[model samples]
Target: MNLHSAAPRSDDRDGYLVSRRQAWFAFAMTFALMLFDYIDRQVIVSLFPHLKAAWGLSDMQLGSLVSIISIVVAAGGLPVALMADRVSRVKSIFVMATVWSLATISCMFARNFGQLFAARAIVGLGETGYGSVGGALIASLFPKRLRTTLLGAFFAAASLGSVLGVMLGGVVAAHWGWKAAFGVVGVPGLLLAFLYLLVPDYKTVELAPRVGHARHSVRSFARQIVSTLAGSPTVWWTCLGAALQLVVVSMIWSWLPSYFHRYHGAASDHAGMLAAVIVLCGAVGSVIWGVIADRLAVRRPRNKLVMMAILCTATLLVFVTAFGCTMSANLQFLLIALGGFLMMCTVAPTATVVLNVIHPGVRSTGAAILALFQNLFGLAVGPFVGGLLSDAFGLQVALAVMPAFGLFAALCFLLATRTYESELAKVEHIRLDVATSSTSPMTVSA
Candidate 1:
C-alpha cells in the first residue's frame, strides 16, 4: 500500500483544530480594529461642513481629500500585503493599526490643507493592508463553510464604523471642534493595536514548509503571486465587479451628507445622522446578504455568484429611482436606504469568491489585489468623478448617473458565474492532490 493514500495522522488533524474560544477572540479583536480603521478613515466625511467653512474649499477639493486616501490605499495595498505574507500577519496588523491611529491623531495638528491631506495619506498608507491580512487571518482560523458568513460580518464592521465616525464627528464637532473629532476617534485604535497583539494566529496551511523547499525563495514568491492571479478568472471578475458596485457605495458614503445638507435643507449634524442611518441599513444588508449567500452556496454553489449579479442589478434600479426621481426627503431617504442595503450584498460574496479560488499561501495577496482594483477603480474614482460631475452640473445629477456603473458590475458577475464553478473545482482538485502528496514518502533515483 502506498503511504500517499494513507489517512492523515492524528497530529495532522490536531494542527488544524484551534479551540473555538481562541478563534472567536481573534475574530472579535480583528473586527474591532477594522471598525477603528474605518472610523479614522471616514470621520472626515462628517466634518465636511466645518472643513469647507474653515478652508473655503470647493467640493472638488473636498472630494480629493477622500479620494487621495483611496488612491494611496490602492497603490500601497499590494506591497504591504506581500510584506505581511513574508513577515507575519498579526505583527503587520498591529504595526498598521498603530500607524493609522497615530496619523489620525496627527490630523488634529494640521493647520493647512496640505498638512491635513498629507496626514490623511499617511492614514491610508497604514490602512491599506489591514483588510487583506485580516481576512486571511480569519480564514485560517475557521472552516470553509463559515467563510462567507464570517467575512460578511467582518466587513459589516466598516458600515458600523463609518456610521459612528460620521455621527460622532458631527456631534463632537458641534460641541468641541472638528479637530476634537479626529482626536477622539484616533485614541481607541491605539488601545486596540496593543490589544490585538494578544490574539493568537494560525499559520496558513499552504505556506507551511514542505519537502522540496522548506522556505520560499524570492523568485518563488513572485511566481506564486503571478500564478495565483493568472489561474483565476473569478478573482479578476469579482474585483472589477466589486469595484464598479463600490462606485455607487463610495458616492453615497462620501457625498450623501453634503447632498442632504444642500438639497434637503438639513443641518450638518442632522444630515450626518440621516446619512448614518442609511449606512446602518447597509451594515444590516451586508449581514443579511452574507447569511443568504452562505445558505445559497450550500444549496447551489453557483447561486452565490448569481445572487451577487442579481443584487447589483437590483441596486442599479433602486438607486436610480432614489436619485433620479423627484420625491420627498423622507421618501428619498427610504429608497436610498434600500439601495444601500442592496449595494452591500456583493461584499461578502466577492470576498468569498476570491478566497475560494486562490491558494491559501497567497490568499492575503489575492485580497490585496482585489483591494487594489476595488480601490483604484471604485473608491478612488467614484468620489472624484462624482465631485467633477457635481461641479459641472449638480450633486444630484452626479449621483443619479453613478448607479449606471452597477449594470457593468452585474454583467461582470454574470460572466464570473460561467467560470466560477469550474475554477472552484480546480482548487478542490489541487487541494486533494496536495493532501495526497503531502502524506507520501519521496523516492530518490540515483
Candidate 2:
C-alpha cells in the first residue's frame, strides 16, 4: 500500500470522497435547501406591514416574528451541529429541511400572533444546524482550492432566497393574501428534502491524534471541540466581529421593504421588488468578495482579515452618507445598495477564517460556534433592536446609526489579524483515506 502523507495530494484529498459530478450534485442539493431556508426566514419581512395592519402590533411584535426564528436557531444550533459531526450530514440535513418546510407551511394556518410566532420558532428549530452542517459537508467533498468560492456561492443562496422571499411575499400577498406566500415557498423545500437523499455523504472522521491509532474517546472529542474554538483567539474575535457586521446586514435586509414603503410612498409589491434589487446586489457581492478574499490571500492568508476591515470601514462610510443625510430618493437608493454589497464582504471570508483554524473532525462544530454568535448576537438581535430603535428614533435614523456598528466590527476583524498567522499555523494537517466511488466508506490516511 502506498503511504499517505499529512499533506494530501490535491487530486485525492478529503478522504475517499465523491466524484466531481457527485460533488456538484450534492452541492446543488445543499445549495437549494440553503436557498429555501432563508426564504422561509425572510418571507416575514415583506409581510411586516400586513401583520401590523391586521393585528395592530407594535414594531417590536412585528420584528419578533423574524427575530424569534434566529433566537431559537441560536439556542439549538450547537447541539444539532454536534450530532451532525457524529452522524450523517446528509441525513441530518434532510430531516431539518422537512421540519422547517413543514413549519413554514403551517404558518399559513396561524390565526393569531402567538400561534404564528410559535410556528416561526419551529421554523427556526428546523433550520438550527443546517448552515454549519451544510458548510462542513461542502468543505469535505469539494477540492480545497474551490472551497472558499463554493462556500461563498453557497451562502449567496441565502441572499437570493431573501430576494425571492421578499418579492414573492409581496406579489402573492397582493394577489391572494400574506398566508399564501408561506405555502408557495414551503412546498418547494419539501420536494428538495426528498431529493436531498440522493446526495452522497462522507463518513465521519475521528481526530485520533496518536500515530497508528484509529479512534479517540468521546471525552477527548468534547475537549478538542472546545479547544478548537477557544484556543484560537482569531476564531473568537472573528465570531464576535463578524456578528457585529451582520447586525448591519440583517437590519438592512429585514427592513428595506419597510424603509422604501414608508419613505418613498411605494406599495408593498413595489417596495419589495425594489429591496430585492439591493439584496441581489448583496448576493452577487458575497460570491465576488469571496473570490477577492481568496486571491488576496494567495500571498498572505491573513490579508483576508485586512480586506474585511477595509470593507467594514467602507460600509460605514457609505451608509452614514446615504441615510444620515437627506438626499434624493434615487441617490439614497444607489448608496444603500452599494452599502449592502460592502457589508456582506465578510460573510464568506469569516466562514473561511473560522474553518481554517478548526480541526477537520470538528469543523461543523466550529462553524456552529460561529453560527451561535451570528444567530444569537447578530441575526437575532438586529431586527428586534432595529424595531426598538425604529419605535424610539424612526426607521431612517435607526438605519443610519446601524451601519456605525460596522466600524466596531472593523476593529474586531483587525484585532483578529493579530493572532491569525499563529492560529492558522497551529491547525493540524489531515489526510483522508478512501475511494472515489460514492458507495465506498470513508477513512483517514495516516
**What are the models' TM-scores?**
0.92, 0.94
Any runs in candidate 2 off by more than 4 Å, and if so which? 1-16, 210-217, 433-446
lDDT by residue (114-191, candidate 2, tens digit) is 999999999999999999899888877876667779899999999999999999999999999999999999999999
* 10 residues in a row with least lDDT, candidate 1: 431-440
lDDT (0-100) at residue 196 of candidate 1? 83
What local distance difference test score does each model get?
0.84, 0.87
Top of the candidates by lDDT: 2
Candidate 1: where is the Cα deviation over 4 Å? 1-17, 204-216, 429-446
Flag clash pairs in model 2.
Answer: 16-434, 16-435, 433-445
Q: Which 10-residue span in candidate 2 carries the lowest summed lDDT?
A: 434-443
Q: After TM-score superposition, what is the CA distance of residue 124 in candidate 2 from its true location, in Å? A: 0.2
Q: How close is candidate 2 to the true structure, as a TM-score?
A: 0.94
Clash pairs detected, candidate 1: none
